[model samples]
Target: MTHSASPFVPDPSRYIKRSSREVPVGPVTIGGGSPVVLQSMLTSDTLNTEACVREALDLVEAGCELVRITAPTVKDAANLRAIREELRRRSCPVPLVADIHFKPEAAMEAAQWVDKVRINPGNYADRKKFVVRSYTDAEYASAVEQLEDSFLPLVELCLRRGIALRIGTNHGSLSDRILNRYGDTPLGMVESALEYARICRKAGFHRIVFSMKASNPRIMISAYRRLVATLQELGPDWNYPVHLGVTEAGDGEDGRVKSAVGIGALLADGIGDTIRVSLTEDSVREIPVAKALRSLVEQFATAPRPRDRIVPPFDPFSFQRRESHRWDRNPTVGGGEPVRVAVLEENLAALEAASAGTEIVPELGYQPRLVEEVDPEDSAALTALGGGPPRLVTIRDGCPYPPLYAFRMLAARIPAHHPILLKDTFFPGEEGDPLRSLLNSALQLGALLCDGIGDAILLRGEADPRKALELSYNILQATGNRSFKADFVACPSCGRTLFHLQETTARIRKATGHLKGVKIAVMGCIVNGPGEMADADFGYVGGAPGKVNLYVGKKAVRFNIPQEQAVDSLISLIAGEGKWVEPPSS
Candidate 1:
């Protein structure tokens, strides 16, 4: 049943936490087999000491282990002293981290006050004008030398101050140097951080954490796996703790589903040390979602084992949907078809009632009488169906293997023509608790979807039929398997945001939520804007206070539109591009 294993993951079959070297952040310890740490960032302006202090206190009260404040300028960075002093005066001892971008001066100023400094390797030294040009070997080496000149001092400062450094890289913001070489890929994201890691190692600095973030879960997951695999290849000392997140994960259920899929999938593979569920809302609201996600992953511990050695059927670092011929044409499944959604027979009416005006509705309902169920561990049972005519088959619940491994086993043994139906639960447990139910379904089903295993998904456990239907489509959207509504990639607000992100996001969503298949990105500032919104069809970004910048793909097409007209302008941009359709009127 098995041959070789991927160096990226030791065993993709179960939840065995990956071992990492412990790095200290003030009073908290990350990695070294420690329980996963929870962290969140402040949305208040750094210049406003009282607001920053208040938000920090709220996050700390909500059980956040680490609090990050953005420092977009030297003034903002210097203001961290006042915020830190106030927190200390209040007797709050939570570790503080300064989020820095494109400013070594700010990072240097921040080091004096905070417990940790997070630097984006993509923009820390390199300017991202989105320039593309090939470099000769000598030219590339010179760029590296200059980068070290600017970055090595920070490494020395962190070492001297006895503080930790996180060389975080965002998939949307990789440097032009990396993009020219590796393209905008997970490999590029990994190498961007590795360059800084090499600098830290050369300078004998060991207190470090690493993160690979993206708005897309597939890219985020792949970057982290490639990074860890690269570290493993670098030898024993490169096991720095990892911080998992999916950046700009919109708000509400969409935000939760995306965060759960991205963070929960990696946790399922045993790969996170710390996590932040980035949402476009109040910072404190993110903590419980993070905790719920951790709790949901804990359930993976109860997963049953496979009868034999399980061989991975898909690449862990890249997404290439598994091939299976479509058995039905109208509501397609497999062989390059959009992943379909299904509901239980009894809940079909509720699903329809719940999805009255929504474009994303269930394509099928599970009729147990028509579909044959097979236990994954029963090899003879799977073999028996191989010679039969193509039909819709579903895996049995309460199997020896969890759905993640169960589906893998089934896919490995069965013929490609038979379409597989995926269910949220592989075993029955408690019935209530919608939050845990959403997290569990996202983790289990999303993990399989990311691995390119599921053809159609049936969400059980969630008692609200409408909520379950929404979760099903949201899971598919988050996994990049399908999109039935306007796709949004929004950043959680920080000190750098120029406008009210929460209100702006809500307004923009109201205007464009009806536009099916349009990918829109709403960013707070330039730091995570242009590049982060690379995959979006239209972008609404903060250019300055009371102003917005609009983009078509990665190129900025409109600038300095008053924030009052931004949503309308975005609609016009979409309309002008022929993506706009009249919203249904009551």
Candidate 2:
């Protein structure tokens, strides 16, 4: 069968624009329009060349696009070289990256054989000169010069050998100058790595990758997002391949969750070029997790495209088909009609008043009177109120006691015989210590509550009450639940804040009240807005009192929209795009 030119067209402009350099890591192309790659490092002793090679091969076999091995000493560097030769001789085609520290000779040796070299700028200080001379301005300059010279040889070797370089900066080992200037922040990490990248570029080596590793996943996520945004602001033409990871990600389940949240968020935003799951266990075990993460990203994420591209037309037929399937399966929406709404509340007068202007049919029931209160007879009434099992439940604030206790009680009271839906609640408390402790406790309690009980969990933060709600909705959807309400998550601005955050957030919430399952975050400043609010479906960040930056799902959609109209504009955009639907009627 001969193929003909069809209606489908692959637009060049739709491709994410990247630097046109050959990424030297295996089949993975980093600084180009290739798929984002997944990589991991081997924890095996580098001095044992055969063991390192075996781990590398295992990682490659497990779908790792690249692998890194540590060369801690000259002997380890020699072993690394031997491993490279063995791979070449055995026709094992995976690319190897050599991670080096203070030993510049080892770095130089590895650069000659490996595809890439990772150097920590902090650890690369010239200790030889520091030991030899007393502290002085002259001595400091000489030390810096000596350090530069040491790296220069490796840089030269890499340049000649066509090896890519990665200036990997870590939070724990930040250079004194960077830490002093920018504090131990994401911006500081970016500055330090960029400074090193500039030095490498000036030395006639341009193939570079960068990573800012932090033990805190949230910080890591924020740092990378800021770095990417900053780079874009500097110039669209300025692009660098990035290596992503959550440093010291611990071991086992906790590490996996942390790594997933950090790496997954970046991948969702089209920011990560490569990933490493930096677990405390044998790093080779991280390879499979890295591959799994990449697969998850490819499966669930929206593909990245250049800003210039006209977005492809959405397939309305597919959407309609999905809705049709849902409607058919839902017994409440018989005859292909929308489901009826039912209100379930204990305060009959308040419920009546709240439902007065709405089309909902009122169903009066006794709400649980206390934490341990339960009535088996209420199950049928609750089901009827929701027209089946509720897909979502909202727990009010001002609980009589600790919120976690209330949640547990509610979870226990809900009937176990039916498909009882999950619930999200708003808990009011002060910020910082109390809220953090509350959230941590809630998570632990939630784990118990969710044991074969609920489908999703949401912890409401007092910083922005609406944001807590929105986060609940997103978390539900992310966990495969099909129902929720819109929530807005806004932050309290400080002295460095750029806009009238409080007023703007209130106005946005009021303006977007009609939409359900939508999430909007109005952040006080641009620095933390993008990263801290990564989970938001829609975000309005303060640029100035009258201006704000708008984002949808990690991608900046517009900038400097009028603060008064930003919320309305976002609502209009969501409606026009038809990306979401009304909550199903009970």
Candidate 3:
């Protein structure tokens, strides 16, 4: 039956055009243009065939199109065969995928019993411990060649029997040769697996799936992006089903969040063909999360809709109406002027010293004020006075109230037009859940509290504070507010720094501290300093102890200042260039 000509359309058929080389795994057609299937493995022991079968049935109900069972030994393979038979007899619908490691004999055995076989190339080449204490390079190669010969028989068996193959690459198990060639990157994983795919294809096998699993979400996302781009470049006909997964995603909340971010990003981008959320705990629960992710992607289909005039739902971040009058009005004071900013110091002496040469206006636009101190009458009067409402309000620590709950209450009481900023407070005993819950709640409230928000987000161990600040600034800047300061991109110096970069940066910051809208970068090494600091308005880079390269944008303006005087020299340069000025006192 022609898919488009049919009156009844299958939901999966709506996304993927049916393919000639399709592999049907239960209700899901893998190779044919079908919505990529989400699959997971049963963590239950295969030795207990009843438990394994029961788990498979549960996963099927949970929307797992395919389920994998581990067969580590000959005994395990026997149990897996029995489970498959039991499920088949009971008329269970989900296809079973057998996962085998190291032992090609076990894989060969499981191939006859399961619908698909998942093999790790690294495991195929593994030498048994009892073989030999002194095998020559040629002898080792001969052993591998023999193993490859044995493995091909299993591959051929699967192909001849119409069983699918998945060349699964785990981050931990990548061969040292591939690592040496491609530096343990996603490219290496793809290249390694493609080589295996070539072997399968050469043996007259076209039914295949590929997966590269990583615990790090960023690395996983990057690898998948690169792989998809590479496949597209290879040509349209080269398309094959790609399985997405964040492997070793720790059990519970951490795993859920990590899997969601990694899987969600790829699904949103229209790349993944299948997904697996590999949590360390019971595999049964993971099926729901994986199915939910696929459902989320279906809602974001990039395929052009049938009607031209149909208006879809607006994505909160991307949608902005030109007719909204708020965009035209100058919503900030100082005629929408940018505010000068400085990191606060506890010492009043240093604070006074930093503010010495800068003009401190009584009210410069929407300064962040303590929420507890702001009177209700004053808040009302400010609205009555009306030259744009205050932008930020810091919730003081130890204020005898939950900041988020209090903010919600305050938001209800405040004038509709006024927006308040809720600052993230650092507490000794606070955990991530409360902070995440509060932040998510605040985001949901929209523009009622502020145009946008900022957090003094702290990082753990060794990360550059400047990089953290830049990331935070980018997030806030994306909100379309112009009153923010230029980001300070500085690196935390290590023993490698030729100059005392940290102290020098502090001094330069002290000198031009009053300049709010200017971005200054302080970097340790010249190698990545210029490139990394390309986004900054100005940069100071260390060359040697007592020497600095001053940059305005990307160009180097001056170099070779005395070690002790480098900070002053950069400051003088800023002042001479009219980038620094005195501030009015309170």
Best by the lDDT measure: 1
Compared with the true structure, what per-residue lDDT tens digits does model 3 show for residues 1-586? 0012211111211132222246655456775657768788875667877888888888888778888887767778767778988988989857888877667888888888788888876556552221224556676456546656766888799877888888887553555555544545667777767767766777888788777766545556556655655665566655667778866454444355556656665555455677787654556777767766666556445333321111111111222211111212233322223321222222224434554543321122222342223422245633442445443333334433233233333333443333343432324234444324322222221111121222122111112323223322322322223224333555433223456544665566566655667767776646325544534677787776667788787677888777677677777777777887664353
Each candidate: what lDDT? 0.86, 0.54, 0.53
**What is residue 483's positional error in candidate 1, in angstroms?**
1.4
Off by over 4 Å in 3: 1-21, 126-150, 302-586
Indicate the worst ten consecutive residues by lDDT in candidate 2.
Answer: 316-325
Model 3 quality (TM-score): 0.50
Best by TM-score: 1
For each candidate in turn, give its C-alpha RMSD to the true structure in angstroms: 1.9, 20.9, 18.4
lDDT at residue 50 of model 2 (Cα atoms): 80
TM-score of candidate 1 to 2 decimals: 0.96
* Per-residue lDDT of model 2, residues 1-586, tens digit only: 1112112222211222233344666445786767777777775667767877787787777777787777766777777778888878888878888877667777877777778888887666522111222346665456556667767777788888877888887654555555555665777777767666666778878788878776555567557756765565666444777778866444444355446656665554455777887654554567767766666556433333322322222221011101111222222321223222221233345545654644232322323331122222245533443334333332345433233333333433343322222222334354544323323322322322222233223343423433333333333332223233344544433323466554665566556644666766666555435544535687777766678787776567888888667777877767766854553353
**Which 10 residues in a row give candidate 3 its minimum summed lDDT?**
1-10
State how far residue 184 of model 1 sits from its true place (Å): 0.5
Candidate 1 residues 1-586, lDDT tens each?
A: 2235687777776666788999999999999988889999999989999999999999989989999999989999999999999999999999999999989999999999999999998899987778879999999999999999999988999999999999899987889999999999999999999899999999999998999999988888888989888998999889899999999998998998889889998988888899999999999999999999888777676766565766677787778777777767447666667788888778777767767877768788788776779977677888888756667778887675557667777777787778788888866555767787887788778888988887899887686677778889889988988878889999999988989999999998898988888999999898888988868898999998899999999999999999999899999999999999998895
lDDT of 2 at 441: 29
**Ten-residue segment with the worst summed lDDT in candidate 1?**
1-10
**Which residue pairs in candidate 1 collide?**
248-490
Q: Which stretches of candidate 2 lie over 4 Å from their true place?
A: 1-22, 126-147, 300-586
